[model samples]
Target: MSIRHGLLALLERGPRYGYQLRTEFESRTGSTWPLNVGQVYTTVARLERDGLVVPAGEDEAGHALYAITEDGRDELRRWFTTPVDRASPPRDELAIKLAMAVGTPDVDVRAVIQAQRAHTIQAMQDYTRLKAQALEAAAARPGVFDPDDVAWQLVLDQMIFQAEAEARWLDHCETRLVRLAPQAVADRREGADNPPSDGDGTAEQADGAPQRSPARVGGLRGALRRPRR
Candidate 1:
């Protein structure tokens, strides 16, 4: 995806101007990532400014042809070997708001979870509509002459996959939260039962009886301690 580096590499093979490099790069890639003449010229200028490439000669119109210098070849090699860190994907604002809802005081976490489940179900409905549309469109197409049409099917497939996945995950979250709601309420209740006073549950509540959370293995889920709110 580094057009700059790719251009330098092509020049390393031989001196070539913008037009030739642009044509060749496009033909080689089956026009996957189209290169414009202006882009090629701009990249060449930057390389020249960086001392990575120099003007080899000129054609009849005095159009500059560039050749990769030793430094340019070195840079091209480094580019081939060095990793380019792709930019992290954009934030999902919905996910951020959901996390906030989970942590916010006075918020009913169960209600928030239900809302998320509903939202995901709505998304699944929308995606299902689009999925049907894509299937119809693909069936209508006889061949892959238009790459855009080909890609449209894949886009719809991906959207469908993601929507269904979100719905399933949301359903799981809702179900688990429903099961845990009574436990959470009971833990917070002030005094239907006695309250613990000692490190062990030895001391009595203000009602003159000891109360504490039930002692259990709590399966694989609860040796870890949550921090005090």
Candidate 2:
């Protein structure tokens, strides 16, 4: 989620001070995307710099109120209509760490993955417990319970679904690692990093360096699975 676009969209509705915008945003998104006062002020400064928003007024402390410009409106629309790309949705530090683990020597990638899996499973259990509490509280309140709060419940449900899927993926990765362990052991007896020159394989390269074609997941599903010369 682009914080700038979210702020811009909020301003498009009308001029708002930093605190009001932050409170309104949390309420509207059901507390999913919590914004700090500093982050909100920083985003406003960026919008002002970009000329996408201008000062409306100020608080008693002289903090500027922000109002959206035509450019801001255009950007807000673009953000809403254009879906976030899964390939590069956002920069996730955890994902980066996992990718780097793939190339690191003396690191047991399986242990790393398993440790993460265990943590995620614990998180999923916590989420489930919280969801149950919410439901129980709602049931007790009955009439006072605003059904709109179900939005948070839905978010919790999606979190659980993703956690389950991740657990399954971990199982898949572990099985693959176990199956390849014997081959890996043999490779270690030789020079582990060296290629098997006599095998049914050759590295494809662009320019003079080995490169991967855009064949996702081994690229063997739709195309013929053959070694490059």
Candidate 3:
């Protein structure tokens, strides 16, 4: 999330103090990304320094207000028009953890995947319940347009969809692991049959003929690259 752009967007509405901006931002985003007062003030100061915002007259309560400049409007417009870059995605902690767990000795990779699946499912259920409640509330008052409720429902929908995708991915991972199990066992046996070289980079057969050690198998990359059954 671009806090700078977010603040500029709110300022585009009208002049607002740091506190007011913080409150409104949370309201618009359904508190998905809460802002601290200090963070709001800091971002506002940066915006002022960058010529994106300028100080407006103080509010009646003596709160220093800021208004977006033309430059800020231009920036906000560009942000709205530009597609968010996903060529290099943010690192996902669960993905990293699972990758590591797959390679680590004594780690239960299936258990890790199962735990994450359960958590994701639970979150999806919670979001679904929240969506149901929001719809019910909206139904109670027909023809009413609540921007806050709409914003919150959008956020909830995104979360639920992400959770659903994650659950499916986990299931795929588990199936892949199961399919690779036989290959993994075969690789282990092959490795046992062709032990490492004895100091000379060569192993001796029963006939005393030297043989090159077979390359190790069952690596994570190899498993991933194998064609799906």
Candidate 4:
């Protein structure tokens, strides 16, 4: 989420002070991406420097206020219209950790996947609870539509979806590892049982380095599947 563009979008509604901008942004996004007052002011300064925003006036409390400029409006419009670049998706730390864990000397790859799956499931449950609360509160309110309640519900829904996806992906990783592991073990046994031969099946590598069959040169999949003692 681009905080800069988000601030500009809020400003388009009207002139607002830095704190107000921060509050409104969080309220709309359910505080998923928090912005400190200092960060808000810093981004506001940059926007002013870029001619995307301008000082409007001071509020009754003497707080400095800003309003979006024509350029800022244009930028916000472009942001809304432009699709977020997914060609190079943001780095997922869990994905990186699991990728590095595969075949890692002493790391329990299955344990890592299971732990993450559990954590994601917990988060999904939390989000579900929050959604239920939001829905109940809205229902009690009758005809009055609360914007904040709706915003929070949407944020909870997004979090639930992401958590569900992560859980599914973890399951997929585990299944793949299980299926590939036995084949890799079989390959190793085949290679080890039948040493490389020189046509007559009586020759060695000659250099004393154990030889692996041509078909099993790079079978590291079994390494991820820890062998039972």
Candidate 5:
């Protein structure tokens, strides 16, 4: 999230002070990306220095006001038009942890995946519950649509989707680990010798199979490529 761009976008509406910008930004974004008042002031100052915004004047309460300039409008246009740079993806802590878990001595990679799956599932449940409550609250007051409720719901939906994707990715990681295990090769050989009657030969692994060190998949680079469901 670019705080500078966000602040600039808020200023594009009209002249707004620091507090007003912070409040409006939170209201529009459902507080998903919170901005400190000091941070807002600092960003505004930088905007002024860069000639993106000009001091409109103080409000009635003596709060310093700012208004976006032509340059700021151009910048905001570029921000909206240009696609986000995915060539250099942001670092995700979970991805980093999972990448380290593979091939690391004494680390149970399956256990790590399971732990993350559980946590992600719990977060998804929480978001679902919140969405239900938000809908119920909105339905109680008919005819009047509150934009804040809608904004919050949108934020919740994004979180829910992310949690679901995380869970799926974790499951994929476990499957990949199992497939790359040494015993998996031996199991395939055994199946070749004594094929299952079903003919699919996709039976589960037998007990007491020898487990080998988990293999790393190109470090953290390949982690972003989610497996198809």
Candidate 6:
């Protein structure tokens, strides 16, 4: 997410070209967030512009190298010490999809949740397999120390944990929906039996058709409105 900071962090080690920095970033992160060569160069250029990095001559192979400045080091240090802000969370597509599905007519919200659960579980399993492989490699080379491997393992662990948490949250959503089903049905029936007027002394459903409001469908929509941290 913070490509600039990441680049600065890598530059702290030694001077590196755009390609080398991109490679190192992917290698350290297990390619979880891949960066193209252009992106690397773009970020480096910005850092140079901001005085966080400087164009350090060139490598022996003629590649343009970049070195971090004092300002860069200070910024990297602050980034390391500061906790990531979580007061405003990023928009989760799955959360938005589920919320919309719950309110939309003729949408099977449970099916959507189940499908996402399956996908998330599969991802978790894949991450678990990768973690096992990483551990096995580490065990085989007990006498050796590879910081890259350690970094990758940490990244994989975070992804695995996130997937597991998502699966659990999906289960909770399913259970809550099931528990509220009866009440939802009752509300729908009541709404159908007593349709609300349209303020012109005429029922909105003048044709005696049943109307399903978001609240009448399920309290799930209301539940989604509350903030969760």
On lDDT, the leading prediction is 6
Candidate 2 worst ten-residue window by lDDT? 217-226
Candidate 1: the clashing residue pairs are: 194-211
- What order do you get sorting by TM-score, best first? 6, 3, 4, 5, 2, 1
Question: Candidate 3: misplaced stretches above 4 Å?
Answer: 195-229
TM-score: the better of candidates 2 and 4: 4
Q: lDDT by residue for model 5 over 65-97, one digit each (tens)?
A: 999999999999999999987746798999989
All-Cα superposition RMSD per candidate: 11.3, 5.8, 7.4, 9.0, 9.8, 6.0
Off by over 4 Å in 5: 141-145, 183-229
Off by over 4 Å in 4: 186-229
Residue 112 shift from truth in candidate 6, angstroms: 0.9
lDDT per residue for candidate 4 within 1-229, as digits (tens), equals: 4999989988998999999999999998889888899999999999999999999999999999999999999999999999986545688899889989985778888899999999999999989998998899889989997777888888898899999999999999999988898997898799999867655343445565567764356343443343656
Clashing pairs in 6: none
Best by TM-score: 6
Per-prediction backbone clash count: 1, 0, 0, 0, 0, 0
lDDT scores of the candidates, listed in order = 0.73, 0.78, 0.87, 0.88, 0.85, 0.90
In the range 161-208, model 6's lDDT, one tens digit per residue, is 999999999999999999998999999999899877655443345565
lDDT score for residue 225 of model 3: 57
State the local distance difference test value for candidate 2: 0.78
For 1-229, candidate 2 gives per-residue lDDT tens digits of: 4778878878988988998889877765667779999988988899899999999988787866889999989888888898775543456565677678767888888898899899889989988997898788778887785644676688789888988988887788778878988987887777657854644445543344556565653544434444565
Compute each candidate's TM-score over C-alphas: 0.44, 0.70, 0.82, 0.80, 0.75, 0.84
Give the poorly placed runs of model 2, Cα more than 4 Å off.
28-33, 58-63, 134-151, 190-229
Q: What TM-score would you give candidate 1 relative to the actual structure? A: 0.44
